[model samples]
Each structure stands twice: as structure tokens, then as C-alpha cells.
Target: MSYFWTGEGGVPGDFAYGKIHLFAVAALIVVTVLMCIVGKRLSAKNKRNVILVAAVISLGFEIFWRGVWIGRGVPVLETWPLYPCNLAGVLVPLIVFTNNKTLKEIFYVFAFIGGIITFVYPDGIFVNSVLNFSILKSILQHTAIIFIPVFEYFTGQFKPQFKKLWLAIIGLFIHLFNSEYLPRYFGMEGDYIFLRSGLPFVIPGVPQVLILGPIAIIVMFVFYAALDRKGSKAALRRKKQ
Candidate 1:
């Protein structure tokens, strides 16, 4: 009796009850709300609000896209439980928790750029599960990514110059290594949509992944650097005040 749920009249491998996925979703909603509250309570001058706003935007984008894809007949949540959406929920909140403007800005830029890039180049894109699994997986995956850099940033180990770029790259690679980026590898036997559903990523190809990965890293650096410059100017203004 595997825990996977099979929805009624849905695709064969889709889960109907989705108990585990539901629990994860509930937890995320609770935590995200709590983070919002905490961020609001912090002094306005502290820029906690900035982090909160960024988190909301980041998380909101994932939710929006998930809905869009599902509406188009791709039950992404049901099929790919460990999707990129999970990363958003988890990592976005860290900015609020840490109240670090620099790190927050870095993540915001990366998310903005990454989202655009993925949307524009959704090569392996396909609908997986529509059961909130994508949300949970993204939340978890991103949480892992944010945790390391957040720890390093606050603990004085992270350098401002390349920290954000490094963190984003590391996060993406970790997703790849842990199979978060390749959810089709683990879903139930018949649920690997990319294999059968004309998905963009299942084909035998090293060109896109290899090419995109480096391009993403470079873009991350460029974005991080620009954000860093802006942050430096802001810091100087505060110091002058």
C-alpha cells in the first residue's frame, strides 16, 4: 500500500486523498502567515517589511504559475510533488526571519530572474500533480537552499560580492542532485509525464541543462552584483543619516 494518492477520474497515478501533500500545504500556509505577522511587527525602519514583501512576491509567483499550468491540463501538483514551487515557500520566508536586506534583495533578484528564465525556457516543462505537491516540494527545496546561505550571511561567513549568486547556484545544483529537479525519476511507475506526455525535459539531451545551468549562474552573478551595488548605496545613505 504505497502512500501515493490516485484522484478519481484523474490520471492513473494521481493521488485522490493526497494526505501527506495536504499536511505539508497546511503547514506552509500557517508558517507563511506567521512570517507575515512577525515581519509586520518589526520596526518599519528595520526593513523587515522589505523582506516580507519580497517573500510574498516570490511565493505568490509560484502559486500563480502553478495555477496557470494546472488550468492548462497539467496536474503538476499531483505528478511532481518535489517541484520548484516548494523552494519558493521555504526560501522566501527566510528573508523575513533574518531581516537581512542584502540577502533578501539577493534572493529577490534571483527569484525574479530565475522565474523569467524558466518561463521563457520551459524546455522540460510538463504538468505533474495538481494536488499541491508542487507547492510543498518547492517550499521544502527552497528552504534547504536558503538555510545554508542565511546561516552563512548572518554568521559572517558569507561574502557580499558573490554570496547570493553562489547560494542560488548551490540551491539549483542541490535540487538536481537530490532529484528535486528530476521528480519524474521517483513518481509512481506510470506518472512520469515527461516520458509519455511530450514534456520538454525527458529527451536525451545535455545541451539545455548544461547550457542553462551556466547561463543561470552568470545571470545570478550579474543580478547579485547590481543588487549589491544598490544595497551599498543604501547603506551609505543610512550611515550618512
Candidate 2:
């Protein structure tokens, strides 16, 4: 049987979407639900500690993964933590540790949306074997991404605000600009956030970056609005008690 630490794996020709993937997806969903339930049960201090520790572990794992890639001669441009998902590794820690409302909002909406999509359609990371470290890391990181925001919401740590959507939009634009323009200025071929070729799906005539950037913002807005409404209803119910 292959072990996660063996480091003896090859990139499969295509993502299988097979048993391992399904198991990981199912496990993530279960764990996220449990976190939401347990988060509500925890004392405020314990909940904060859980959030803080999870954020630190997520950020640390991301950095460690990048370091491993760099050690394996991966280019700085490709491994940079600038992609929306990678950025979440950094932003999540900041949100938890500093309690920065803007960062929290950006992470709660954008990260959750991105996390869900990436989890559902994990392309490269969905290996045929469960014991592969890359696949395992991918599953864990995306699980954390999906879990954190929801846990925060369930614990009343994050209250979605429509105005905070602007913060997320600005963050997206900054990443887009860096991914698109800074690479040219530096004479590097970088697709930092998949803005250049878009995600796996792209519209025919429109620039991939243009199409994805706006769509991402719009999707986040919709998610934020829905969650905000739900939270408001829950708040009202609580007040009635």
C-alpha cells in the first residue's frame, strides 16, 4: 500500500473523479457540518482558539507546500501564494488572528465560493490514490477553506454585510492586476490566479480574465446576500426567544 510520505507518485493522465475523490468530498462535507455543530457548542474562548489554530495550520501548510515545490525547483511565479485559493491560506489567518472585519468579509464570501468550486472540480489534485501527499494536501487545504467561513458564520463570528463585498472585489482586482500585468513587466510567464486562461470554462470571445473576474465578484455577492439574509432571520429568531 502506498503511504502519504512515500513521495512516489506520478501525475495521472486525467482526474478520475473516482472513489478517492468521492470519499474526500464526503469527508470534507461531514467535517464541515461537524465543525458548524461543534462550533456552536463551544465556549467563546474555545471557539476562538479553534479558529486561530485552524488558520495557523492552514497557513503553515500552504507555506510548507510552497517550500517543498520550491525545493523541487518549481518557479517562484507559479508557486506564489497569489491565487485566490492560495491567498485564502494567508487571509484566513489574518482574519482569525487580527479580527480584521474587511479581511474576514473577503474571506467569508470569496474564499468560501472559491473553495466550494475547487472542492467540487478538483482537477490536478484528484489523484487516483488516496495516499498521495499532493492529493491529501489538496483535500485538507480545500476542506479548511470551505470549513473556516462556515464555522465562523455558525459561531456568529462573521456577519455578512453587503458593503463588505467591495472589499472582496478590490482584493480580486488587485490579484487580477498582479497576475496579468506584473508578469509582463517582469518578463515572466505567470498565470498566478488563472486569470489569463480563465478557469476550466471560458466564454468564446471575451477575455478569460474579464469573464472570470466579474463572474467571481457577482457570485460572491450572491453568496454573501443569501447568507446575510439567513443570518438576519436567525438573529430575529434568537431575539424572539
Candidate 3:
């Protein structure tokens, strides 16, 4: 139990990209593809239910994890609203339910790209930890971030316009500002964006942290190529109408 919550007797990076990690990603991709195959056929009620269930799970795990962190005596500045995944877990639900197209333009990218990166690499966190509460919570929460937006797209709910790319850039500016200044204001040492801190996931000589901005921009477009979205806007509009 202590291993589950407190991580008292666990090894770090135990499952990073091992079989379990690959299996998990494969499972999610399979489910996402299944959803894509039958998304348009699903009823509105069922779609809403699916979204609601995922949102609750993501938000619930985030709260639980935060409680664990606080209970374990981790600093608040370092834990809450600090990282991209943190926001993706905590805020993405609110953005979606509120139907905030603008925030979606920003966070949908976070939910997809940030979630994929962290979920895949998870170096210091999930990579090494045995299957405990921390690992379960981390996996579920990360899955939610990646799953929700992509699921929405699969269901014809979100049609991202490339011209709104600036919205995400501006959102990242705010994120970077908060990352650098928030901890300083609180008199705590922190690296929320992983920009100052060396990233656990790597690109060898190039600092992986520097790539986040460009990656964010690129992924806003890649959902099209990656998902094989054909006439996404027209399809989405036709569905909505």
C-alpha cells in the first residue's frame, strides 16, 4: 500500500518504454481507432457520456495525486498547476465542458502532444516504478489528456483550424511566464516547463525542452496527417449542421 501511494519501495523508470508502456500506448491507439471507426455512428447521448466519464476520471485522479503529493510533503509550487500535464489533467476538462473553442485551440494541443510525450517517455516517474497507485494514477491521467481531444476529433466534435495557431503560441507564452515567475514569486526553486531543468526524455545534443514550442505548433497540424483527417472542417460542419 505504501508502495502504491507513497512510492516507498519502488524503483524509478522501471516501466518507461518497456512492454507495459508499449502495450498501454497500443491499447489507447486501438481504442482511439475503434472510436474513429464508429464515432459518427454513436449517439449524442453516448458521446456526452463518454466525454463525461473520461473527464471525471482525469480530474479525479489529478485531485487524488495532488493530495498524495501534499501528504508526502512535496511543495505546492512544484506540484500544482506547474507542468503541462498538470494543466492538461486539471484544466482540460473545464475547457472542454465549457465548450471554450479558444482554450481548446490551446489545450487540445497540450492534451495530445504533451500527453503523448510524457506518457511515452515518463523517464523518472512511470518508467521505473512498479505498478502502484502512483503509476496507475499517472497512466490514467496521462491517457485522459491524450484520449479526450483525440476522441472528440474522432467523434466529429473538434475541427482544429490551422489559422488559430497563434492562440496556442500565446497560450504557451502564458505557460512559460507562469513556469518561470510563479515559483520565483513564491520563493521556491522550480522548473515547471522543464526548460531550465534538463528533460528526462532526450534528443541528445539538442535540448528537448526547447522543442516544445515548435512541437506544439507542429502537432496542431499533425492531427490531420497523423489521423488521416480528410476534409475535417467540412465533415465537422456537416455533422454539426
Once fitted onto the true fold, the runs of candidate 3 whose alpha carbons sit more than 4 angstroms away are: 10-14, 75-78, 127-129, 199-241
Give the Cα-based TM-score of candidate 3 against the true structure.
Answer: 0.79
Sort by TM-score, best first: what order?
A: 2, 3, 1
Model 2 clashing residue pairs (backbone): none
- Across 32-144, the per-residue lDDT of candidate 2 in tens digits comes to 88888888999999888888888888888888887877777888767756566776766776677888887776556777777888877775666545457777777777777
- Model with the higher TM-score, candidate 1 or 2: 2
Q: Could you estimate the TM-score for every candidate?
A: 0.40, 0.83, 0.79
Which digits, one per residue and each the tens of the lDDT, describe model 1 over residues 1-241? 1112222222334342255444544664566456545554556454334444555665565566567557758766543334343444445555556656565544544544444333334333223344344433344544433433443343333445533456666655654543333554545343221223443443455545555566667777666566477665665588799
Please give the clash total of every predicted structure, in order.
25, 0, 7
lDDT of each: 0.47, 0.74, 0.71
